[model samples]
Target: MLYALGDPVSLVLLLLSFVVAVTLHGWVQCLVASRSGLRGPAAEGRTRPDPRRHVDPFGAVSAAIAGIGWAKPVDPPDRRNRGALLRVLLSGAVANVVVGLGALALLPLLTSSVGSLVTFLGPSRLLQSGIEGDLAARALLFLGLANLMTGLLSLVPIPPLDGGRLLFGLAPRSPGWQKAEYQLDERNIGVAVLLALMLIPLGGPQALLPTILDTLAGPLVRLVTGA
Candidate 1:
């Protein structure tokens, strides 16, 4: 029962951090879209910091279950500007990474002790400690790690993901690329592929999603925090 209950405070912080990251991610995309001359929903106030403006119900649930998820999709006013589309697509991922780095930078202010830093970084300790360190410290660590992982995950090349869209924007208008894009759109296979990757274990005890997050985001977190 204790295991199930498990650090309600940390859970709250984690959720809050995730919401903030997602909100920033969406808002940045909206801002970029509008600035790129593709004004639409974002221009009309969908870019608000409120999570409601950007949260996708399925994406939120996925983030809670997995370590990474997406936000509500931002539509372009038109496909007329390839450069604008690329910028809009990439902005959200950049926002997440920036947020993650910012959170890491703020960690020292919360708790400067090396022990607390180690405790947060250590995998076994991270899961076992729950909300052990200073509230602000732990919260910032959670936010940093969450944002970093989500940002990197968004860069995975698959349809519907930011990286995939960026790739599409860069691809030449050759018939082959167009056919591939059309196939991806028609079958909607990327989401399935992404889910499969997220669910399957990565040749070890750990699941793929968390493992990837830890492997990629962990080092970056350490580098930024100097832990």
Candidate 2:
């Protein structure tokens, strides 16, 4: 819904946030892979934080609508080191978490600066009062909270997601683990299951996508807001 005509301000904020989140995620993955001695696609040029180098088309659109999206996968070079693989797989998620926290920490500053701007401009008294009220504050809060929720949602363990790769890296190469990997392949039914969870509406006023992100991000958002 990036082009949706409703609520342009919020849509733009969320679109920008999603872009930054995915860029950070891809760059971190490439960095980790490069450091792990794999000069693969990510290490070559995908580490530049450019959308063309990292963002998948469907993934980006889905993210704009669902609040959680992914970037193109960066395959690591042939290496038998499980630890290195784990690091590469987990780096993207770590980057998202870091970005989300940084955004949260900036919320108060953003609102305060907006206040200062309004005061300096000597806006109408009514306008000043409204700005000092919840509008700007809520906007900043939503920006922060949206990024946090998106990052957390990216950590859901399903095929082709970072969390799924994390699990594969962590598990030993046993029969069960191999079976799980096979079943969780990118082209398998796992992707369908994930999409269903994201697209389905369970109850009033909210779909499963936002509901899940909210549930996962609730505690962390509270901690960040000191709520």
Candidate 3:
């Protein structure tokens, strides 16, 4: 997502925004897990907002290439507590969206220099958002957009991502579900499939991940920015 920009300054701004967004996503998940009564994240010092502590190397590469990537998995202190599973899993996404909208909500409050409607237009227009926009404001635009996109993208029902594991945890106990989970989660099949979807441009509407983000992330931007 940040790579498409022709301007070096814009690219740098976007790169920082993306890194911060991904870091925030992981930190929030860990924070939520700690607040939800899980101690492992806290015990391991994963609660800090450090990028080194959270960003997965492959996930970072994926974010640069596909615009939708994830952070390192945040597991509960006790994975046996299935009830805590939903809270631990869903918090990451909720954090991203809340941060995204929160950034948008604070836009009008920014110094009028950069708080113009251009700053509110959303991620799609970011590339052509007119270089006159304030760097800080443009960074916020990228932050909000990247967070929203990451939140949605992470929800795709595939393995390795939080959403897929969340679904697997929620499903009723069944031999089929168990076997499928074993193959996808245990055997790494889902990880391979997810990589394919992100790395391969399967063409047309079948291009899956990009299409999903394009279709969904845009409206969120418009809705929040009032554009």
RMSD for all candidates, in order, please.
Answer: 3.7, 7.7, 4.0
Q: Which candidate number would show the highest lDDT if scored against the true structure?
A: 3
Worst 10 residues of 2 by lDDT: 121-130
Candidate 1 lDDT tens digits, 1-227: 01213778876766776687778888888888877776685556875777889877656755665545677767744445777877888788888898888878778666665334544553222422345657777777767766776678777766667777667667788999888777664476766677667656678654665565566666676677676
lDDT of each: 0.67, 0.60, 0.70
TM-score of each candidate structure, all chains considered together: 0.81, 0.75, 0.80
* Candidate 3 lDDT, 66-151, residue by residue in tens: 65677787764344677678777878888888887778666656534333343344343442222445777767767777777778
Better of 2 and 3 by TM-score: 3
Please give the lDDT score at residue 213 for candidate 1. 58
Q: Which is superior by lDDT, 1 or 2?
A: 1
What is the alpha-carbon lDDT for the whole of candidate 3? Answer: 0.70
Clashing pairs for model 2 are: none
